[model samples]
Target chain A: MLTAAPERSSHTIALVGLPNSGKSTVFNALTGFRQRTANYPGVTIAPFVGWVHRDGHSVAFVDLPGIYSLSPKSEDEHLAVRFLRGELPDAPTPDRLLVIVDGTQLERGLVLLSWVAPLHLPTALVITMIDELKARGGVLDVEELERRLGIPVFTVVGRRGIGIEEIRRSALAWEPWGIPFLPLPPDASVEERYQWARELSAAVLHFPRPDTRSERIDQVALHPVWGLILFAMVMMLFFQAIFTLAQPGMEALEAGIGWLQQMVENTLPEGILRNFLSHGILGGVGAVVVFLPQIALLYFLLTLLEDSGYFARAAFVVDRFLGSFGLQGRAFFPLLGGFACAIPAILSTRVIPSWQERLTTMLIIPLMTCSARLPVYTLLITATIPPVSVGGVISAQALVMMGLYLLGAGTGLIIAWLLRHTLLRGAKAPFILELPPYRLPAWRTVLGRTWSSTWAFIHTAGTIILALSIVLWALTEIPPVSVPPGTPPLEAQRLQLENSLAGQIGHLLQPLFAPLGFDWKITVAILGSFAAREVFISFLGQLYAIDVEAAEGTLRHVLAQTLPIPVALSLLTFYVYALQCISTMAVLRRESGSWRWVALALGYTFALAYCLSFLVYQAARWLLG
Target chain B: MGQTEIEVPLNRAPLRRQLVVRRYEGESSVIERLCELGLTIGTQLLIRRRAPLGGGIEVEFRGVRVGLRLREAAVLYVTACGDSNAYRSS
Candidate 1:
């Protein structure tokens, strides 16, 4: 071991272990709210770092991604190994290592210990899940294990904070001295190492027969036929809960934002400031913020699924289907979450072990028809498709909506397959998922995770959305034109909007969209809606509301009367395929850690939308004419 | 003893049959990974269940449950410990 002077004021210790070893739970207990979780294997990934106050000094704990061995076969494991060697750029070499070993599966953990122990760092072992071990009538001789390994081994029930303080104190006082090396052949094969681990485990660990509860549960959870049925049912309920539970909170937020906008309108004098405040700032930002409850609910349910150890089984159940698409089984949850929103879905892709699979999943998640598209779909369907009942039960409009959703999902899967073969061609990573024992999710951990993700969403992507909203507002507000006398108020407003910068840009882009049967006004709405897809409805509302006195009906009626069937159909198809949401772009950039991906996603989606919409419009005109 | 031992890919093993890993038939790195998961030569594993649609197999080893894709499981060579009659019964 290399000796170096230790920094007194603060120290960094990396928490390393196998996946499902409760390392994160221990980190959360030590660091409280000072931690941040992120994708650890991606291009822009970073280890989760949290600070804890111990004694008089502040200690920062870096929670590296879990891996079974230092010799990594997957990208996540590679990252963990790199971080331990202090080779990661901008990451400090940890002064000490806190290796977490699962007490119930000591032999598996000992293999990892044999790998890490040779590094000769100031290391300590924290044996977690001891409660599970004891519940199965097992006992571990920690003192004897400590003697064998020459490291302080603390038995901790991390979930319940048992023996945590003693571990914390020992970790804080860790020094690179008196650590004995295990006696092994200098050139030990992995099999030889495993043999040594087994012998050591036998010396210090004693247990009754293995508990059969998890195995019994696995019989049902892993059944070839019933498992898939159970998985589908569970996922269906999960997505349903995301939509149903978050609806009230979403509506309440909308009302709250609407109230705030009204107060601003009533209080402020009518001017550009009022318009910018209500429409630009509040409206633009509130549009994204209203989806927070849904994002939170999606993450909350996902955390529960992951914590309960069912996620691994779900992955196992879906691996074959996912493998055919060059995706991993873990992509199932993230793709399912994409139906609610793509931002959190992208964030949750961290669970996927392969970087290639994760990126492929990220690129395709936006195509899952997020909730943000509902408003635009509803507006177009309400205007174009009448409420004729099919079989006296289902409405034709509802069927059309369902058809659009199916189209989006179908396109997403096809594109994922295509990308896998083209841009992301590589050998499929090996799948070895650990099915942790079933346990009720720690509510505190779930809530904490949900809160952090929500906050991170608002803090990082929220600002970008706010800025784009302001920019869009300015685009429509600038180059004010004078209205002639005797022009009605609504007509004057329309004239001003037509002469504005946004309108001019719309005219410039009109020729491109003209093939899709879109007018300049529709083009302007499309441009403004780039802030978010749902903004398309409000933009159309504002544009159509201009001819209020001259129009004989509601805005919907006016839109229906003015737009031909071909044009309306083209517009709906465009919105269905278009990557128009700035927040999603921002989140994608953040998650992938590459502006290149963001540009590629935007370019391809726009290209697809334009080509498909043009084809639809031409076909409709040809058929109807 | 070696000639009499019946070896098969782990993925082909019957459910509920106990097997002892003899060797891995893939890349050395793959073998190393299996060893890290306590599936080294001489380690005992019980075949739990195959996943739906031939996705993977669930196995119990070292008091933990592990899921492996069919391709990875196929690389693991193991010998059934009990009589052939017992394996056929399951």
Candidate 2:
């Protein structure tokens, strides 16, 4: 046996568990909230790493991806096993292994531990969700479990902070950790290991009742007819709530920004600084931030659905439909998330167990017409389409907006099908999803997740959105035009924009976009929008310098007068199919660990956008003429 | 019909009825995954219900609920428990 003890000053500990085993809750409890996610070298997944300072000896806790066993079938499973065996490049082999198991399902947890025992790492067991187990009238003999496994056993109700500090103190005292006894022989077959785990768990645990509540819920949730109806109703209520609930908050934020802009205009001198502060900073970031209400609410409801265990049943219900399109039910989550923002949506795709399905979902997510597209769609539709009711029911503009959303989603499904058949064709991975027991979601965890995802959006807005806004401001305002003193301010701003560098580039690119009926000004907006779809509205607002609200009469009259019906229709079509978010592309690059998908996504989306827009423009022109 | 002749692939196993895992009839990798999840010869599983439009089967075993796609579930052959058809450890 090796005699060297782990360094006394610091230690690296790894946490592993099966999915939905409360591993993350324990990790959060141990590490607090100051966790940093680092992508493993050459891998598509990034595990959370955090540091806990105890008694002046800092312990770095690595929350490895959740897996059922150490088998290397899936990429996440492969990464976990590789990290455990010190085979993952650049990642330190953990000094000790912290295995987490669900208190309710101790047998399966023990089986997982059995898989890791052959490595002979100094290991300890953390049994989480003890509160839930006890609520079901289950009892666990923690001391007996420790004795049988020959390792330190800790039971934690991670949500309530019970038995957490003890784990932390034990982690700090790392040297005396026992080498966990192998639950089964190293060469034992899977069946033997499970039998051993069953016997061992039967000895140390007793549960008098089953999770009948989950079964009762699943009967309706997974029913052939009622399940679909419940799913549809849930989705409808969810989106309806998002729009209605977020409206007032959105208006408040808009008013808040307007108030701030007024203050900046009043305080700052009338020059580039004032214009930059009002239009460039507030206008750019504020436009994106205005949607935070919708995003936060969307994530909140999604967290509730997920924590209530309804999300898995929803996935099961939709599996056949998505499978027909070469996707899977788990793809539903990311696709739904796409309606909010593609960045977090792509991150959420980590739950998908298969690589091809996950990548397919990520690639097509931008086609879902994210919240960023709403402003653009609203601007164009209100400017062009009349508010007269279609068939005396839905307004024409609202109908058009709904049609655009359908077009985006339908195209995404078609593209997924095409890619599945051509580029990403592979045998479907077995879909084995564990339906966790239904419980009232912990409010703290739900709120924490919602806040973190919302924060991610704000981070994107601060960096990418703010940067793009500034760049567009520079491009449109540089080489200040020399207008006569009597020139009107609005006219002067337009002249400055037309004479700026962006104007020259727009003119240069006009011929390329002319087939889709885009003039140089619209071309400039499109070019700026390549960084972010929402940037198009800000760019157009700047180019027009129409101080009034964009959806109001003045800007609408200006747009309707400047562009014919055909051109307006074409631009709307282009926005529907275009992949307009560079931030999403960057995330794709990072997640896929290759620039190949990024290039393909950019290429195909642009081509599809151009062709579809050209066709719409020509068709509308012919019909109108 | 004799219980022995009524053995069927797990995908066709009757819903909410206890069935015994009889034989491994799937690819090795798939069988390994099933074993790891505690589905082994002679182990009993209760078929909870099929998903909407026959997408997958939810099986309950060892106090756990697991959903398996129809294709994946077809790999295991199971017989009704408490019968001669049920496999006995040799």
**Each candidate's lDDT (Cα)?**
0.80, 0.82
Q: Model 2 — interface RMS deviation?
A: 2.6
With candidate 1 superimposed using the best TM-score fit, by how many Å does residue A366's alpha carbon deviate from the native? 2.0
Cα deviation of B70, candidate 2, in Å: 1.2
lDDT digits (tens) for residues B23-44 of candidate 2? 8887787888888888888788
Candidate 1, after superposition: displacement of residue A542 in Å? 1.4
lDDT of 1 by residue, A118-196 (tens): 6767778889988888988878998899888887888888888788888677656654533437777656877887778
Compose the digit string of candidate 2's lDDT tens values, residues A105-159: 8888988898888888899999998888898898998899889889999999988
Fraction of the real A/B interface contacts present in each candidate?
A: 0.87, 0.82
What tens-digit string does per-residue lDDT give for candidate 1 at B14-49?
788778888789866666667777787777788787
lDDT of 2 at B72: 91
Collision pairs in model 1: none
TM-score: model 2 vs. ground truth? 0.92
Clashing residue pairs in candidate 2 (N, C-alpha, C atoms within 3 angstroms): none
lDDT of 1 at B33: 69
